[model samples]
Target: MEESMRECMRKLALWHTRTFKPIMTHDELEPIMATLGFLGLPPSASPGGSLAWKEYAHSSSSSSASSGGGGRARPRLPYPRIDGLHSYTYQAFVDGVSSYLEMCDISVLFHIRGMPLHRLDLYKKWRRMQEDESVFVYREGTLDQATYNLYHLHRRGGGGSNSGDGDYINVKMYYGSGDGNGSLVIRDKGNSAPVSCLVPLKDIIL
Candidate 1:
């Protein structure tokens, strides 16, 4: 890692060591993004007929709060349509986001730092379309700050877009407790654990 990147990791480690503690539930954590100036990151656009999608995805799953069914099935809304994108859609983005959360363990430093979230080549596996997208992840637990910083570097293009034979960024995803402070993670190539960064949607080009 470059000196600047290493320094960033140290800072993240310090922050994590200091703030490691219990985290709030997803409901309590959503508001912090807005309060922390991430409100405009992306407009809350749900796609039309999402209810139908949910109804189909979990047709047999029961809507029990005690069971694991409460958090996954969300009401569908109208989202913006990406013109000319062969496979991109709000559903793909949502699927990718869900996979990241379900599969990746965001608490460990080395484990989380090795996630392949930005690998467009593996879009088919993640069930995402080839189009512009924005995603987010949040959880509660202890994380190695340096690992988190490495993830941010990947997301911000600091990690050169190269991974072996494929053109990609080798960065792992990030994890944050729902306490307002958090990191963003993306995938490239097959799967990459990326560095974390606070990317505001207003600054995003896609």
Candidate 2:
């Protein structure tokens, strides 16, 4: 068992090194977060004239969640610390999906380029691959930014490194284009050489 654990860890590390490449940028991350509504409340103009009202609502929700009253509260999820929008072409998005999967400890359901990958076979294989390894792989599909319900994979675990390596962490994001497809980014923790994929905007949960 010890040996097996070591092997898994070793493979995981190796896989991360090979599959995880630098993609995306701090500037690019901001817009994606904003579009996804992950960034805390933006400035609001009101009689109070302060962001306090936004915080109040956020705090209320958090407090309710803490009390365990079974309120469906949005958990505080980790997002990029950097500021700005992630700009990448659609091709980049597709390549990045494989890397995105390896970085997740928890499952992430993402929609991109009008190809929602919710089928039982896809999800099952994704979970299975994730449990035993850490490399990105892709299967060919007719992914267009239009006329398709984009697919996605999100990490349920708070976004962080599994290896405790400060150099890199796995990250994901969503982008909005006027086209039917939105954008999804999966790249290194440092936002280098990211693989950006497009998804049909209609497929996004929001």
Candidate 3:
């Protein structure tokens, strides 16, 4: 039953992050608490079920479950604290999801020329990708700006690296005609034995 309680609280923690609002009001929290109140009861557990069976099964202990002719009310159930951090706060919730999430760096490949004239823009690319099942997308716990910058297209690797490191994090479409990206011509500092090659943009075009 402790494990069941932990599992439900973990989902609540996830919801708090998904809404991008971690601070919940007392009234807002009441329903969630009430839902969890019966987790150890007969409707929720199995035969000879749980170590927590006594706590939630005893209706006399809880005001919500008790008759009007009641004795002292029992205290609220403790926070599941599955992450082992005694505190429950926004940072703790963020840490929990970050740990739970399967994170990876993204590489975006796109072409603007194929878009319909009526809706000609880069933002459409994001919307298209969102609808594509092949593309993996997830919502952020907090709102953020979508900052896409237009830069002179630079081929990451034709024969060799463009930057100091061989790794490249970004790839972009050339915005204008007669630009550098179509066959990168790299020359040594001494301007000797210039290397030229093309990183094809055919895969990106619709």
RMSD to true structure for each model, in Å: 17.4, 17.7, 24.0
TM-score for candidate 3: 0.15
Give the alpha-carbon lDDT of every model. 0.26, 0.26, 0.23
Q: Relative to the unseen true structure, what is the C-alpha lDDT of residue 101 in candidate 2, on a scale of 0 to 100?
A: 29
Report how far residue 189 has shifted in candidate 3, in Å. Answer: 42
> Where is model 1 poorest over a 10-residue stretch in terms of lDDT?
8-17
Give TM per candidate.
0.22, 0.19, 0.15
Candidate 1 C-alpha lDDT tens digits along 150-185: 433553554322220111122232334432122334
Query: What 10-residue stretch in candidate 3 is worst by lDDT?
Result: 105-114
Q: Model 3, 20-61: lDDT tens per residue?
A: 332223334334335434223222222353312111322324
For candidate 2, the lDDT comes to: 0.26
Q: Model 2: what TM-score? A: 0.19
Choose 1 or 3, whichever is better by TM-score: 1
Give the runs in model 2 whose Cα sits over 4 Å from its true position.
Answer: 1-126, 129-168, 180-183, 191-206
Clashes in candidate 1: how many? 31
